[model samples]
Target: MQLALPGFEDYDRVCEGLQEKATKELIASYTDGREMNPSAVFICKTMINLSRNFDILNAKGRDTSRVMAQLLSWFQELEDKLPRASELKPEVAALLGEAKA
Candidate 1:
C-alpha cells in the first residue's frame, strides 16, 4: 500500500483505473456514489494494501522488523524519485519520518 501510494500521483485516478479490473470488484463495490478526494482515496488504498500485505507476510512467517524495513526501503526509493516525479507533490518529501525534523 505504501508502495502504491508513492507510485501513484492521483489516487482517484488510480481508483478509476482499478474499476476496469475484475480483481478490484471488492473495492469498486464500495466506491460507488462516494465523494472521495485524492488524499482520502490514497489513504484508504494504502490502509487496505497494508492490511492485506501484512496478512500475507504474517502467514508466510516473516518478522515484523523485516516488514518495516521493506516498507521503509520503499519509501526511501519514493523519496529518491520525487524530485523527478511527473505528478506527485514536491512537498511529499516532508511527509517522510526521516524528513520530519
Candidate 2:
C-alpha cells in the first residue's frame, strides 16, 4: 500500500537525512508561532488542500488515490506535529480563506 513514486521516495529520503535543527528551521519558514502545529503546519494545510482537490487532480490524469494515500501517510507520520480540529468544516473553511491571500 506504499503509494510513493520513485521521485517521492528520493525526496523523502533527502528530508530524512537532514539534521533535526535544519528540519525544524525548514518547517519554521512556513509558519509562525500562532499555528497549532507550528513545526509542521504546512503538511496539515497540504493534506486539506489535496483532499479538497482530488477531483481536479483526477481530471488532470493524476492518480488521485495514490496522491491521497501519500498525503495520508505524511499526515500520519507528522500527526504529533499536525493540527487538530474539533469541527473540520470550519477548519477547512479557514484553510480555504487563507489560500485567497
Candidate 3:
C-alpha cells in the first residue's frame, strides 16, 4: 500500500536536505572546537523518534504505512523545532525493540 500526505511530494528531498545540513553543521562545530548545536541534535532526535514510533506502530498490528507517512509529514512540518524530553520516554524506546515479526 502507498500512503502519502498531500503537498509533501517533496518530503524526501526536504529530509535529505535537512540531513545534509545537519551533518555539515555538526562537522563544522566539532572542527571549530565547539559543541554540536541544539538544532543538529534536534534533527537527529526527531528522526530517531519517528523511526521508533514507526516501529512501535507496526508491531502493534496497526496500519503503520499510513501512520508512518503522516508522522513523516509532521516531522517535515516541525523540522526546525526541538522535541521535549517527555516525548522521548524509555517506554517508547522499549516498544521500538519489541518483536514485530
Candidate 4:
C-alpha cells in the first residue's frame, strides 16, 4: 500500500489515476466525510502526506528522521490493520470454509 501510494498519489485511486476529492473519499469508503480511517485509511493518508514532503526535504538537505520514522510507523500500522489478502490465507480459508458450510 505504501509503495502504491507514491505512484498512485492516493491509495483510493490505485489504478484509476488522480481523481476528484469526492471520488477518492467514496473509493476509500470514507463516511461522515472524514478520512480518519476506521483503521488504515488515515495511515494511507499520512503516508501520502509524508512521502510528498520527504523527498523535497531530503533534497534540501533537511533532516527527515522524524518524518521518515512516522511514515515507517504508519506503514507498519497499515500492514497490521489491513494485511494483504495473500497474508490472510488462513483467515480466507476459514471464511471460505464457513461459506461453503
Candidate 5:
C-alpha cells in the first residue's frame, strides 16, 4: 500500500538522491570498508532520524513506508556508481556520530 500523499511521490526521490559518492563514502567510513547496501543503510539512517521527530507538528506521523520504497528505488537506480565512491569523496567520514540518547 503506497502511503504517498498527493504531490509527495518525490519524497523517495529526494531521500535516495543523496549523492552516491557521499553516501558510499559515509558507509565505508562507518563500516570500515565492509561491503554494505548503500540504499538500505541510507534509508535506515534517515528513517531512524525521522522516527525521532515523527510526532512533531510538521512531521505529523508521515507515512514512512512510502518514503522507504522511494529511497530503495533511488538506491537501485544508482547502484552501479557506488563502487569507486570510496576514493572519490572524503567528507562522508566527517559526519558526527549518531545521537546517543
Candidate 6:
C-alpha cells in the first residue's frame, strides 16, 4: 500500500510566517546528511514545533501537562520504530538519543 504524504497547506495554515520558516529550517537540519524518511522528517518537525510551544506554555505558567504527554508519546513512538543500537549508525543513534527516543 502507498502512504499519502501530508500536504504543506496544513502546516502553512497552522504555522504563520516566521514559525513556518523556522519549521522548514528545522526539518532541513534534521534531514541534512542523513538518510531519513520524508515522513520521519515531517514528524520531527511537528514534534519540534510542539516542544517549542510546550516550553512557551510552561514558561508562561500555563498548564502544559497535556502537551508534555503528547511530546513524550511522539518520542516513544518514533523510538519504537528505530533499529537496535548495534544495527544503527552511531550518528543516527546519537540523534535518536538527543530526541529522547
Name the lDDT value of residue 94 in candidate 1: 47
TM-score for each predicted model, relative to the true structure: 0.31, 0.35, 0.32, 0.50, 0.26, 0.48
Each candidate's lDDT (Cα)? 0.47, 0.54, 0.52, 0.59, 0.48, 0.63
After superposing candidate 4 on the true structure, give the runs of residues whose Cα lies further than 4 Å from its correct spot. Answer: 1-37, 89-101
Clashing pairs in 3: none
Candidate that scores best on TM-score: 4
Q: Write the per-residue lDDT of candidate 4 for residues 9-78, one digit (tens) a residue.
A: 5655433322223333543552333324466666676666676567657667899898778767876776
Look at candidate 1 and tell me the lDDT of residue 70: 54
1-101 per-residue lDDT for model 2 (tens digits): 46887768655344232223333454455334435644465665565455545545755677677766865676566655544443357968689679888
**Top-scoring candidate (lDDT):** 6
Model 6 regions more than 4 Å off = 1-34, 85-101
Off by over 4 Å in 2: 1-35, 59-62, 82-101
A best-first ranking of the candidates according to their TM-score comes to 4, 6, 2, 3, 1, 5
Report RMSD (Å) for each prediction in the order shown.
15.0, 14.0, 17.0, 11.4, 15.0, 9.7
Residue pairs in clash, model 1: none
Residue 75, candidate 2: alpha-carbon lDDT: 57
The alpha-carbon lDDT assigned to residue 36 of candidate 3 equals 43
Clash count, one per candidate: 0, 0, 0, 0, 0, 0
- Displacement of residue 28 (Cα, Å) in model 2 is 21
Q: Which has the higher lDDT value, candidate number 1 or candidate number 2?
A: 2
lDDT of 1 by residue, 13-99 (tens): 443322124224544554544555665466445545544555566666786565445544544443343323233465664464346
Worst lDDT window (10 residues) for model 3? 77-86
